[model samples]
Target chain A: MSKVRERTRSPEGDLPAPTPDAKQWVVYTQKREGAPFKWAGTVEAVDTELALQYAREHYGLDEACVGLITYEHGDSVDGEYSIGPLVPQKADGTDGDEWLVFTLAKRGGNHQTAGTVNAPDAATAINRGTAAFADGKACNIRVVLASDVHETTDEEMVIWRTHDMTYKLAKGYSKQVRSKWTRIRDNPAYEQYQKEDIETHF
Target chain B: MQNMLADQLANIVLMHADDKLMLGHIQSDWTGLAPILEEDIAASAMAQDDLSHALVLYEFLGERFKLDPDAIAFDRDPCDYRCCDLVTIPDEFDWATSVVKRWLTATFSQLGLHRLATMTEGDLGDRAKRLLDEQTIQVTHLNRWMTRLGRGSIESHDRMQAALDRLSSSAGMMFEPPDATLTEDESFCCGRDELFTEWAKGIGITLDAAGLSATITLPDRSTGGGRRGEHAPHFIDQHAELTEVRHSDPATSW
Candidate 1:
């Protein structure tokens, strides 16, 4: 049987759903040479403008003499966001312990995948990344930790170049990697048998 | 600085200082509770700056009256406070109200602080001006969000409008006349600068058109005097929170 994805049927079906309750994000603005702007608190919106607009109403407007903006990953990457793993939820309602940090330098530098973080939030992760960057002496870099990131397992696998055989290379790197979103089987441990098969290639 | 004009000027200056102190007090409530972690931390820094500016003015005022610092700060009642009515309203948990309110306060504060900074008096006058320069940084911070939301999505536009509606009316009191002490000096004091007028011209809207969601009316004098030792009972709790250790065993230093 030929397989067809659901979104292939409808264009409007492509939009991501709204973030659920208690999973909302609040925005803060670091104004240029100004008091940190504490705009209104709002839930994570679908679009950056939506988030920023909510943020602006919440934090700016009454004050004058500046442009309004919130600098976050969603504002930049179109759909590359959320391509990896869905952010896991913490029982405490704050972000999870695990984190993935990225550092971008050299005037719109590519966010060098510095590594992942197991820290609490983006700020702390950035602090660590900044120290690392400063030590390495890489000047003029923007540090952004992949906020709200986590996973069920670090050593997971993605199906290697074929759909017929259950042969997945360990650690998710493959000749043809998935994009947008992918379902790796209900149980990631199922890939264990394939892990044994990959040792031969090594 | 000795003229009634100067004295009135002093009252005006006091009003500005008092407003910062009071606004700072209210804003600090959000230090740990802001919606986002980054925002909460950022807001906390701003709160500290506001309080620091207040301290600068309070120190000057303390020297004038020979009163202890806390007495000028926590001891004063609400009616005694020279803060504009805009700051006294309960903090709406919503960020819209907080930002809009802060935005309004910062704009006026920038002008007021600058005026004080340039005053002829060398002592507090010069000091207040320096504080004002620092405060301008905050104005820049809040203004960025204003433009974003003002030109943002429809939902954001409505929310901004609603915040304006809710917070605008209280703004009138920001410019109300000071108690007799403020009127004592004129040369170095505050003038009824068309702040509202300038604000409208700079931003391009009357308070009504700005989309504030609430109306503020100055309360009758019965619950008056946050500056001269009259205050809400809630202030008692605040004093307790801030001064518990300091007041407890004053002989024991931390």
Candidate 2:
């Protein structure tokens, strides 16, 4: 709803709007369990926490996703500053930062964290990673620094225990109730007959 | 005794279904009109979830009450529907108010569903358990939006505070049951007092985390007529809109 407010001039006679501290985060979505994280889209937020909320609502809601992870675009370094395969480089034994490299095994499929690479920065890691682990169709690549990942403790994981309810599982309804028509006639081939009749009519 | 309990159970379920249907309709109103494209799509998805939940409950009620689900949902008069006033309040295009309302209603529903999932009596328990996953998703989304808006820009923060203050009066009525008898039923899992305590604690935690604890006062039992099927003024219009298509051609089939 719109609210009408009296115009009041500031001492500075209307200072320009301050720029937002929000950072652009690249979002990846795992559509289901065991699926790879695909580059879904981007969101602007102040931190990973808020970025997650935006990412979940924006990229995660449109599909049946199991999880979403986001990384700041600014976190990337060097070559082209985009998510993709990189040119190969000679191995220099410098013992650099550990970066987790993810790649799509096929075109328009899940982007899995295929392997890790030790390199000076994220760009080199992607380059080395793609050269090392890239299959024929490694269409997209993403690299995250190891330090960004958070681990959950056993105690904190307890909140996820939802009273052992199995109703959410489809298999929970595997046992079917006997149809009321069974009392009228015990026909083992009832389903087959119904299927044939429907097919014939159509 | 058994019949009375069954009737009470039906009433409780009916209230939930009605609340969901109304909330779902209100949320769908913002489908194309939300401030942002992402939020617009998200709200629409959540609205679909709410409607799906309502349909499930309506189907269950239809079986128990021996009526068609469509008739139960659309053909009833205003007094026959048992939704609370909190969900029935019009948002008047205020994004902040809608966010607050969605958050409060989702939290209340989540707690209620959790308790119902533990019920040992009937299939409602199983249904409640099944619905928990979707309910949790909606609650998390709404909760995040609530926090974001509450602590966002100065104007947004002010709007949120005002919405919370205005809506808090009837917020307590969410925990109110249709009758005193249902509370005592062990299968229902919780009484009004217990549910209220859990709800208050949960809400306090959420608000505190969002940094709005000191700014807004949580309203307790003040205005409540929803339990007896008395609705807020806006509910009639909502009911009309929801039933418009269904009423237009009662004899037609899609």
Provide DockQ values for all models, in the order shown.
0.02, 0.13
Candidate 2, residues B71-114: lDDT per residue as tens digits? Answer: 88788878777788889888877787889998888988888788
Candidate 2: how many backbone clashes? Answer: 1
lDDT of 1 by residue, B1-254 (tens): 12321355445656776777767777887765675564575566567667777777767766766655555665543455566666655554566678888888888788777667666654766786566545655665566556655555666667777787776765655655565343313522444444445654544443334333344443332333543334446555544554455556655621
- How many clashes would you count in candidate 1? 63
- Model 1 vs. true fold: TM: 0.50
Local accuracy by lDDT, each model = 0.51, 0.68
Error of 2 at A113 (Å): 3.7
Top of the candidates by TM-score? 2
Task: Tell me the docking grade of candidate 1.
Answer: incorrect
lDDT of 1 at A33: 35
Chain B TM-score by candidate, in order shown: 0.76, 0.90
Model 2 residue B84 distance off true place after TM-score fit, in angstroms: 0.2
- Name the TM-score of chain A in model 2: 0.53
